[model samples]
Target: MHLQEWLQLLCSHTGLKGSESEDLWSLLPSLPSFSLSTSSLLGLGALASLTAYWLVTRPRPMHPPCDLQAQSVAINGDPNCRRSALLKDENLLEFYYDDIRTAYDMFQRGVKITGNGPCLGFRKPGQPYEWISYTEVAQKAQWLGCGLIAKGCQLNTQQFIGIFAQNRPEWIITEVACYTYSMVLVPLYDTLGMEAMVHITNLAEMTVVICDREERATSLLENKEKGLTPKISCLVLFTDFSQAFAERAGKCEVEVLKLEQILDLGRQNLKDPVPPQPQDLAVVCFTSGTTGKPKGAMITHGNIASNASSVIKILEGSFTFQQGDVSISYLPLAHMFERMIQLSLFTFGARVGFYQGDITLLMDDMKTLKPTFFPVVPRILNRIYDKILGSVTSPFGRALLHFAVRRKQAELRSGIMRNNSLWDKLVFNKIQASLGGNLRFALTASAPISSTVLSFLRATLGCLIFEGYGQTECTGGCTFSLPGDASTGHVGAPLPCAMVRLEDIPDMNYFAKNRQGEICVRGPSVFKGYLKDPEKTAEALDSDGWLHTGDVGQWLPNGTLRIIDRKKNIFKLSQGEYIAPEKIENIYVRSVPVFQVFVHGDSLQSYLIGIVVPDREVFVDWAKEQGFVGSYQELCQNPDVKNAVLEDMRAVGKEAGLKSFEQVKDLYLHPDMFSVANGLLTPTLKSRRTDIQKVFQQQLSSMYNKTAS
Candidate 1:
């Protein structure tokens, strides 16, 4: 009860009205116990008032503060080198499950623990989500593993099983089955292109390919006809195959079978499982190849197992994974970040719901599942941030929104997190409801998110938004921001299995002594090596086992890591001023019109140019507001629209404090976007700069010539 309510109740029980209560209060000062010197009475009253205020206004933190001072310890008296606080003398973290060493082992443990609990979920067009229990999943995976063995797949660690499809129950089932039978799993997606797919298949010497759709299966046969993949002898379809398609496969000298057929074969001829050892090869995760051809990174069972276990150990104290926890799987399963998340969930027997193979329906899926754990990328978060801010059309409402955010952010710094506050109910409740209103935790990776967006989401969503940093070669994540950390612009300290240090990048003017240089990670979670490429392996992993990450970073005083620039993606202008296009592109993409931006600078030129793909909806809306009428393509080509977008980009750049030379002075607004499907972006959404430049060579040349003149 409130203080006023208590006082009123006391007065009613004592049979005293307001005036009578005031008289009693007035008499207390003149009572015998209060008959003291005036100075003594005044000092007692002051102390009581101070005590009451302190009791009412003191901070009530909800979670423990991150020990920033002890975040990492220097190694061998070198302040520049560091390791995780959880580590002891550089020893790697053990697996979360004592006996579980591989991904398949994790499923078995889940079956033993969660039993009939839902493991995988899917939704039909008009139905709610249907779930497959852990026991059922285990049985299906067993049958599938034996079926592959019966179908002439070698039961050994070197046997490569390729999966080329979107994320689904079948995709994960294939992955678990491959690990169950001591086979290496190679994941391929549409973004890899036909040439890269064929190259991966041949490089892995994969004899069988499993797919979800008919087009994917047909493409394999078509590629065979083109003499690209001669070794692939079998095609397994998760969906049904028509007799005509079976005949077509037979004519192409390839065997085709449905999923049910394989399960039946396995049921008829059940064999003992051949589990993989810790050192056995588990996956040949291929890089998306932003610079060159996709190279397979050989990940052993122990590598991924240790990585997942280390991550879980670090998070368990703050956000423990439980059986009832649910997550939406929408990010490409082909990416290591998503794969690691799924693996971690499996270890804890959590449920995973797959999207309907459509990213546009992700919010629909989230509403249906009401997931508690949300794993996202920065692109999705940025869109959500923009959409919510765009909804408040009035200046006063926007101002109020900003003010509310500031208030909540102040509470966040005091370690308080609550959603029932006045501001949360009035201003941010609807914003939270858009994400299913049950997001207890979220991890944003794959790219750096702005501090404004991160802090805003933390306050509005009422969840711990952890920022993580890693690469495919490190088996997913190496560093993750702490749970209670409110600071932004850093990826936090290293995980227990990862010991990070900086190496001098002399050309970039970054030095280890200055706590700024190329980030290098060394640990048990690092990949064994690049498959079939000794030169690249040697380049990535030095003799001391440190994986040299090409990104430049600075170690903050508190031991967190802040990404500064792209060491490998930087270029020099004619005036010898170095330009980092990625940093500029990141800033320019924040403009309302731009959806994707490719900032380009020529060493022969003094200024930069950009190829911008305007956000279709926002750009069209803006054009209509300006009294302009044209088709989407026509609007893109309109010189006035192009100039307006360029000006907006310049405004954003100026706000971000970009150098004059770094800002793009000329721009070509393209109607088409740089995407993975177009082979202009990697699967991770990083720009394939060489391919993008190739695609717009003529336009780039025109822009440069005009700027030069």
Candidate 2:
């Protein structure tokens, strides 16, 4: 019998028959044939509505679809030469500051805007930071400039003032003094070595050398005695000097004056400032030479100002600098990257606290200052990540930490970043407090950071951390990641002052048509040219004003740049395959057992080799796990330990999709780290490839001989 008829009869016999039941039976008969009952149909309708609501309210992607897939616009129908996808009219973004054309002008604007606000900061090892007001800084700068003039230093851009010091208030003061007086400032650091220092001083013909310590002044006098830098006529010491040093300076025919003396001279002489024009050379920044002599990059007032202004505009919506904002300065001022950062901070009237000249004390400085902004490199961030993860020893603690990270990452994906969530309050608050408990933004640059570390820190810190890419030639910034970008490996679109393009690197098999080639930058930020090296300048800057960066880059569909290889760092193997040691090193360094790695490839060989400095603690832990115990140095020589590390590296390389030729076929585990102190690393922590190779020549040859046997 039909179900509808059966239901109707059953209702009638049971004395349950009514108009409502009859209508229900009629509706069931008219309903489309289905096994689902009326209740099931109602449940399905509710589920569909919920699904529709979810579809509409779900979190959108961080970047637009076009940004994720579209190619940058090619210039003049040449796919090889492209600008950012955001540009349609092909015009670069204008400068953020309309009137500020020079760093001196920017500083003056800051003095007017922030007035008596804290400008520079200093502190003892254990004390809170002390601040210098903007007005005081301006006054000091003027006095110093006048003093320099009174000391017979020329009052024009031709006069080069050499500053040999770490990051300190005195260092910045000297810089501003140079800027305001139109004197060229040349920074000297320990990493430059005596030879490079002598080279730089003589090349620039510096008459005055301002140093923070007595030792620096003595060193200059000694160099004068050796007749290496004879043009150095005045020694200005920021610290108190001894009578013996004064005598030494007198014998060297150099006038010795204390910083206070210079200030007093300036106070008596009081001259008006001679601020430079836009095109005037602001600084002669020398690159940290890893293989050859350092080349001084002649950065103009407009080059640096425009770069800073462009960065400010790009980051204004996300990281607006305020008078109340404070930054810790630990990175070397000699490096263009840090100098550019400080310049931007000064432009916005922010406070900068100098670290205690020791990297180990950086966190203590941060804790005392409670800095609002942090500019860092991957090495430091990696250390922080390792320390934080290592501290959670308990299984429950690890689980909870992982859970919190996952939850926060989900929120990040949903376009919500919070420092007040339940997970944050319970788990990540402590982590945030370790970094001064007040960090609102941070930046990582100079090297690529792992996505795992980046994501973890983004969730734990509950603030924005941007990655930037540039060289000294471009005034330290070419491109920077957007504020909320969650992706990794790509340094974001070009800054407003930078017009970036890609050219075919045919030798490296990189083609711009394939969205891969050498990165070329054009715009106001490009340097005036390498100081005194026209041939080098011509090679760097093409006829069309594109500065060809030696970095090999692949353009992402999102119009972002991913630095893939170093065109100059590539070497051919016996099999005719090109191997980029830096590219392979970047991957193998991700192994937990590896702390620092350098991959080496010889043209005569068919395979690559590596010299790895393992993370001491982790390596020891693994050794103990394997029931072997020894001192770190002894274990480094153990064959078993060597094989284990090699295997771990292999696993990491495989996971990273490294080709067989790219993977290290043999490994040498070194106990000593490649450090700047050892002359194996540069001031920026980049490996001095030639120096490292020289240091490990014996090991390298032994490994190759063994492989051949």
Which consecutive 10 residues in model 2 have the weakest lDDT in total? 62-71
Q: Evaluate candidate 1 by giving its C-alpha RMSD to the native, one decimal.
A: 6.4
Q: Estimated TM-score per prediction?
A: 0.89, 0.89
What is the Cα-based lDDT of residue 449 in candidate 1?
91
lDDT of each: 0.84, 0.84
Candidate 1 Cα outliers beyond 4 Å, as residue runs? 1-66, 620-635
Per-residue alpha-carbon lDDT of candidate 1 for residues 17-114, written as tens digits (9 for 90 to 100): 55456754554445453244667656755664554455444445655334765677788887667877767676767576789888778777778879
Task: Enumerate clash totals for all models, in the order shown.
Answer: 0, 0
Across 1-709, the per-residue lDDT of candidate 2 in tens digits comes to 4445545554554454354345446656466654546776567546635544554444443433125344256668776566555455677654577888899988888898899999999999778889899999999999999999998988888889999988899999999999989999999888788898888999999989999999877777888999998888898989999998898888878989999999999999998899999899999999889868899999999898888887776666445888888889998898899888888888888889999888888888888999999999999999899888888989999999999999989888665666778888999888888889889889889887888999999988988788899999999988877755677778887776777888888877888779888899998899988889899899899898999988988877666788888887889999999988888888887888799999998999999998999987677877787777898998999988888889889999899999888998888999988888899888888999999999999999999999999
